[model samples]
Target: MTNAGAEGEPPLDAESLAFLNRPGLTRLWAAARTRLERGGLQPTGTIRLQNLDAQEREALSLLLARPVTGPTATIRLPDLDIRLRASAVGRGLAATLAELGPPLTDRRAARNAAQAERIRLWSAAETTLAATPLAGQPWARPWLEEIRRGGTLTRQPSGTALTTVTQAIDTLATLFPGTTPGPAPATWGRGELATRTTGSAHGLDDGTLLARLVLRGIAAARGADVPTDAPGRRALWRRASVIPDEVSSTVLTYGLRPRGGTWGEKTLRERADRALETHLTLRELRTLRLNMPPGTRVHVCENPRVVEAAADAGCTAPLVCTSGSATTVVLTLLDALATAGCAFAYHGDFDWTGIALANRIMERYRAEPWRMTAADYEYLATRAELHGTPSLPLAGPQVAAVWDAELAPIMEAFGVALHEECALEPLLGDLE
Candidate 1:
């Protein structure tokens, strides 16, 4: 039997070896080549060949030194290996197949190498993320999982996309306070921040990998929903006090006095005896150092009309108006004041969005809810409805006044809206 060949047995004649390399053995060689490419071609395997011509059957019959019993038959790998060796072919069947068939690329090994590369890339990114301050934050785990599942760094893949994302994460980590001594407070434009951190001015532009990564981190840190559009993204950056753009953003103020010799101070110093309306552009805000004396109070209002009324009534109290839903400009001014040890008392309209804005402003600046309580809403709302004070219906879904938990239910129950102007006499009365 072909399998009975002893170890180190002399191989068959040279003519037999020459015949094995001929095209006659092509069909069997193709089968062996298929298995080798899939993985290592093992001994003692069977390959089923179909629709074999007379020549091919005769070739197999000769190679195995057995009768070719059927047009299609199972080829045991071990039988083929032993026969090839005993026939004085190259060392074994696999070696002969390589010579007779197209070169094998070892697809299984290629796949394994690709998988290993992917694991290595992810491990590197995770290691960097773990070492950063954002690692343990509320947003880290889900963000990391997204990276893993997507198989590419960030939402889109570019040549440096992974590196860009990692840099953004590291940069965002700098935004939080650390165990060590902290850096002095500083604010920057998005381009300036990108240039300083990643050495590219536009590295954190909208739709960029760095922007996407940092946005996710900020959303997690601030407990804000992830933003999708340009306006939403700009608003998020503004929340972080990172200006999206300078010229377009402005905050309104009156009765502000900072201890400095700048436009903000100069303007206020000139109008020392009376309140002066000032529109502080973001560009101007960046240059001014707000260092109000401790215990100073800065009243924040949701509407410009409140500031106007305060000014009109000769109210000397420092007032800031958000103008609408507080923009980044408003938050920036408020944050600076808050940092300078200025106490804030925030008042807004008695509506759903109004309560929400108050909650955000209060939470961010630690502002006292000025007349923003359930009792306040009930009093103002009841008075408005009774006095025939024409007002918009309390529109939008109800929002909880987290500062005063009882406020939301009272407002929802009243179903009538009241604005700060509605309580103008009382609000101005307190301002003086």
Candidate 2:
């Protein structure tokens, strides 16, 4: 930099080469550069040179034209600037540092620019969601916070984060459309909802960035944790009225007939007559008729084996099996059955997941907990071989038992999972 142009400083002359290239002066110049750069290239404050060697002191004395002797010395930028301009350097400090290798950067300015860009990104995002139902909801803040914390929004190119936010808000807004306190939106296929809101059929598909973001909002709004598995994800979407295809989303049933002559009712009557099981889809249930009289107790279970057991035992109380996690079709069937004046006796496994399913059924449908209580868990847990099966260890996160408050804590204490199959004999007796 002695002979070449300084970094953001005026070009240096041959006469200043000795001073710019002088030994022991590197530390002073580096400190000055750092100070000025840190101050955003605007301040001319003092820079301290600590533990000065003989060369540094001599260089400083020569540069400042003072008898410098101390181990530390504070050099003022204004003095250096004046000296640099008048001396053979022929320019101020900025240009001089530029002539030196590695150009100076205004770190403060860089930070400010980045911050402004972030503000602009989110402000535009707010404008993007201004018209949606999500704009001012309580869950919106947490969603935005999670997005911010995850760093997904800021890790990409400009405008991309906003695009992501817009997609999530648009998809969510569509999934739960209409004013607050209104009826639930009609269920739609996952792809169809994604296409309508985000212009991509797979916009909200599982494992997609948009899917994760959207699920976070759904969980936050519902005060639930973000779903992690395929079944869990589908369940969350189903709760939001987004469903799989009618064919893919079906509920298993066995026994007892509705009085109506519609396809579902006739199918139920025929299935019950033969003691066979039938799986009903939303499409079929939508058009098929049913006429369950008031107080008609339809049994609901979380596993298909229960329905199988009921069928095998010739138990004809009309069982609906969730087959694991209850799908949208299962929920719709339950709602329809409830509308038709059918009471429900819901049973599930005795593990944490089963308890969760029971909570949802009990909370949503007011169904009675069938063989799903603290007493039932304790009785089943005590016998290693209940219903000819060994008791399994409870796995997964604990869920609150809304139907019976003591059920969750009891299960936690026992650390045993009494599956519905283990209670099959008694359940079969009840069914008969």
Candidate 3:
């Protein structure tokens, strides 16, 4: 035979054999090889392998029958020493491909079961509560807020719960006299108690209790002989007939009264209470000047003493005093004025807190910030001797975006707090 080779002999060229046997090329190819057997076919533009050597390329060619069109491809090696193709080779890949596993199915089933249970519980609770008397009452607002804030009537100390429940029972008894006292548990769960209490106390289902309370309130208002126990429905109806449409009309008229009148002294007080109750409008002074017939000039003060001092000085301007934290009266008055299309010019302390309060009043009632600008602060800075040292750097959560941005900065710069009453002389002069 020629020197070509013996039977079944391997390739004998040293360089060629060494090149074919190069570990770097094999290692690189092995590392770069993305085993996408468990994954879907790669998208068209994805890079499949990086840093290919000549031998690796030849090996890949011999293995692959067709050109690789994507990041991953299947290959069949018939003649090479190695046989490799994209196949589910291990438990991991097989598990993924078959899409079956007890753990996964169990987890999903558990989650679904939990959701179903929650829905069942919520529905049951809602159904039970819907039949009660307290349904759709305003008491739910604060109760809901308390619940959101992690309050529980049950968790309340026995003394407190007893007190509250006693009051509720007394109120209910007054409304539903001769009605059997329902099972009142000492410590019911929050949702359970809310549902039960609302239904029983508010008379939402029968409304006999509600009718009784209404009659009692009306009788009490009119100085009539009222029953201590639940008043008869017919008696309530008779009393209700006096006002005819009292429920809707009374609330609507009460709400509208503040915004309707000529900001008179008595009317101002009524509106002040309403605004305070509704809007929480607080101010130091409220001044009303009488310039024209039925004239309405009202000034609000942050300090009661300022109003008192103004009055002492024989200042005829009608005033309302906020006292602090704008009581219900102050807000009601403000709302009344606002409803009547009366424009308000507000002044407050020059400190950060005052700025915040002034901005709040302005925002809530659409009142104008009178002399609450940086310019105003700057002018006031010249008049008042800074005292009490700048308060611990204010925790400024929100600032009026519309007013001068410089206002906050100037307060920070001046490092002083000035109350509205301190600058009252100037503000009062402006009214003139």
Candidate 4:
């Protein structure tokens, strides 16, 4: 009987032992051995080894001391010839049989399956949140459902009060045990906490988010981790000023004014000129108003060129150009005009872009839409021989909930764009 070595005994030729010393060679032999054990080769009992180089065959022969047969030749090893033949034959048979079976999955199918699973998870979460009863404030149920569905809520709830972060965490945990809530504000800083609270507010304006991000960026620039709800952050922004006056002047100028301050005719005229020359926004408008003259008439124009032309024409009425959205300066000037009781008439291009901008100004500052009606658009469409390049597509996502719903459809129908210059004469007529 051949004695196998004791379990703990070291081999006499430790360096040459394939399984113990050379992991790579041992792995190859084990894989071949497994195929032999599994009956994966061609014949039920015989192994037909192929794809082996002469060196690998010699190694196998030395390791097993077996007789191995391949497609080209049969090499006999004294002790293991039968085993090697069986392993190879089994591997070859399995490969041949697999080729005759059903097809394997392709890449597209795997991707689609993964996407379908993600949708299923998202849908399940939506359904679960919708059904769950929100305690205390019944109206919170819909808002919570919206959040679960990944929709942002900007308006404050008029019905039921909204849930707190702690309550939200609990409710979410019940629905999605796999998810963990993020760290509380105290972990990072007070400023971060304030920002998170403002974001989660059911009644916060959409602009609040933009303001928060801007403030946080400023805090980061100052090497501070700003809290989400930091009063300090707000105060810092209030104190900070933007140069050249155009950017910061508007919000600051209009924003700083007392609600009912009288802006007389003289005040409006002085303020409008100061705003144009200095590019002051609503905020800066407040500072300039202290010593402004009375009973000034402000002329509002859509194009900066109109403002320039008015100035060049020596028109004395205080003039302003929207330049696009009512910048802080524009809003400030409008607000000052309103306070001073100065009548304002606005005019812009008769195209869709003009209509949209007019709508935004009307909504944001309660400014009357200056000659931006459907009639105005139709009249301009017929009169202008050389219209500006067809109104370009809108820059960002359209918020139809607040905007003129007919504007997009009108632009699509016209298939052409008109600029402020096309309607310049009629607008100037209104000014005269």
Candidate 5:
């Protein structure tokens, strides 16, 4: 019989096979493993083994039943198969290698897997960044750098969930008053804004994951605090005219009397202890038709406490509290007042967020900066420093103060926060 006659005999036992695959011929084994993983073992195929040692050459000589020439040898798979069947007591070369050790992964396959993973992460990040309104603004670069450092706004791991976040941000960004004064910021019903921006009304509803990502980004861009509750989120959205859940998003005012309504007039007359805490909704503001006497100065405050104090002092200051960020209703009233040639004097907390709000208010309503100046901040900061109360650290993102350019530097130097309440006594004195 030929040397290949033993077809029914069992292959070498596991222990002998293990010794055969030990460190000596590791390079040859690795080459065979790659070939097997890429394109399964077959007769008439060739594989090259490099840097062969004496032990490896001997192993190869025994396996192939032929002498190897040198350090490198291109072994024919068919020849190895015949040799393995005849001498190694195996059916084929594949069966012999299987008895030797575990299978190895192809290097090319591993590289492709890694490349695909990188693509997925970048695709999600790029999509979200491009959709944010700040994408074209100065803050976009730093914000993107923050994201690239693995500060993901959404905890979602799936591509579909991240894409949903991107869509929501796009919807909200489109609502922020566009630069260069195009069409008025699209103030639609909450549902309408979602549908127009993303193709579904429920896409940006409150309590959703997408909603949280969008809200956080909005607060970041505006240098405002990250809202914690439903009311807080609504206030943030309203500030941008995004109007998420518009019906519930209302602006609180103490003394806002427009010429159209007898009630508005009545509210203005019944000032003092009977302050009108009018809460105007999105729908009401959109359809609102009110006018004020020309050159009227409407005093705007950031806090309800200031407005409440103004009302209690019986100051008759024509005060309007933005409550937090100016909601759609506040903006609507201010816009109407501006149309009738009313001037606005806005005051807010003396901090980064406050300065940002002051800038936005003055720019939008052509309002003058009221007690929101370098002098104002410096006076408050100096008093606090002298009294051993250094004020809270200047937190939130840095924003430039166009109204008083030096105000930003003074705030940075002092690292103090002067809230509207801190200067409440002086503000009330001004009202009188």
Candidate 6:
């Protein structure tokens, strides 16, 4: 292996170093050093210089004491060693170059050492995985492959990648907390897990290596592409029953009068009486005494504007609006409502992505269509056309509207997207 040279070696005298560092002779010495490192310390083979400018040719001629006339110059390794030993450098080319530039390195030896280390690290990793619940699982293979191919472990700041591998695997095992097969266990918060596992509450913060590593395993097990956006990442964490950010990730509501006296419930009641929208954070959802009381109707929309418009119109009914992509917290609230036997009706934009979101929401929450039908889309598009409003081309991958099969085909044929804001009138009318 090559080492950093200057630390242990005695400094070469300035005059001996100056000869190798001359401006015109710089490239010549570099080529010579490259040959030594790749070929090993003992000088052999030849160094070739191509496209020599006037200054380099003059310097070469001066050093060799022979008139050099070609565009290319070649120096035999043994000949140069003998030449340098006889010069003021007073050492062979290996020692001379070592003194002048970075230390001499054996490229082949370094490569062999690196390959051996990688094998050792991966073996150690497999052994560690074997000790966990993930042992012998098919999904574990993908997790192992992801880290190995992505160099996740090797990129660690210290030898801690292995130690981190252990910590991360242990943390991941506990992620699917209810796997014990009975009444499901209570879900864990990120801070609680981080504090217990890492001795620091912030240890699993987003973008932290530990969080990213754990997420890779989750993605691998799900056979899904690793999520790149915050919403996608947080959604993956939620699958393991981890609430990423209870206080920040929230569901927006208007006119929800859950009878619970808890702060979250009371806030909703107050906001509704005053005809205002309330943002219900995931943290509050845990403490709320009332959430979609049995037989109550719950309306879900894709945009916040519909909720705001409902509040403005003094429509006092249970309404939830997923501000954009329905987040983990939004799903949490919906899960709570579903458990309480609330009826669900969902609506979103008529775009491809919106249809996809609607599919998940309706299927998971058993929601009926809330003016989110093909007829609704056709009406909106025709109205816009009459008003001279251009239809925006649908973007993103096509998603089947499982709730209404005809919806996607019509949207595809129309080749335009109609957002919920365009349908605000009827949605608000329904709430009223």
lDDT of 1: 0.75
Question: Superposing all C-alpha atoms, what RMSD in Å does each candidate have to the true structure?
Answer: 17.2, 11.7, 17.7, 18.3, 14.9, 10.6
RMSD of 5: 14.9
Deviating ranges (above 4 Å) for candidate 2 = 1-201, 204-244, 385-391
Q: How well is each residue in 1-432 modelled by candidate 2, as lDDT tens digits?
A: 435574455456565766676887999888988998888885488999899999999998988888889999998898888987787767778777777657889989988988888888777767766777776576776677668777787777767777888888887777656544132557788888888878888787678888888888777767777877665776777777777555766888887688886666777898899999988877787676677767889989888888888888888787889887866778878888888889899889888888877888888899998888789888888775545655578888889888888988988998888778888888899998
lDDT of each: 0.75, 0.80, 0.43, 0.43, 0.68, 0.78
How well does each candidate superpose onto the true structure, as a TM-score?
A: 0.49, 0.54, 0.39, 0.38, 0.49, 0.57
lDDT winner between 1 and 5, please give it. 1
Write model 4 residue lDDT over 50-106, tens digit each, in one string: 566665555555555553344232322222434433542222322322222322233
Candidate 6 local lDDT, 170-206, one digit each (tens): 7776664333312115577888888877888998899
Error of 5 at 127 (Å): 27
Q: Tell me the deviation in Å of residue 257 in model 4.
A: 18
Q: Candidate 1: which stretches are off by over 4 Å?
A: 1-244, 271-274
lDDT, candidate 2, at 351: 83
TM-score of model 1 (CA atoms): 0.49
What is the Å distance of residue 93 in model 5 from its true position?
19
lDDT string for model 3 (319-371, tens) is 54555555344565566566555566666666666666666777776666667
TM-score winner, 3 or 5: 5
Taking all chains together, the TM-score of candidate 5 against the true structure is 0.49
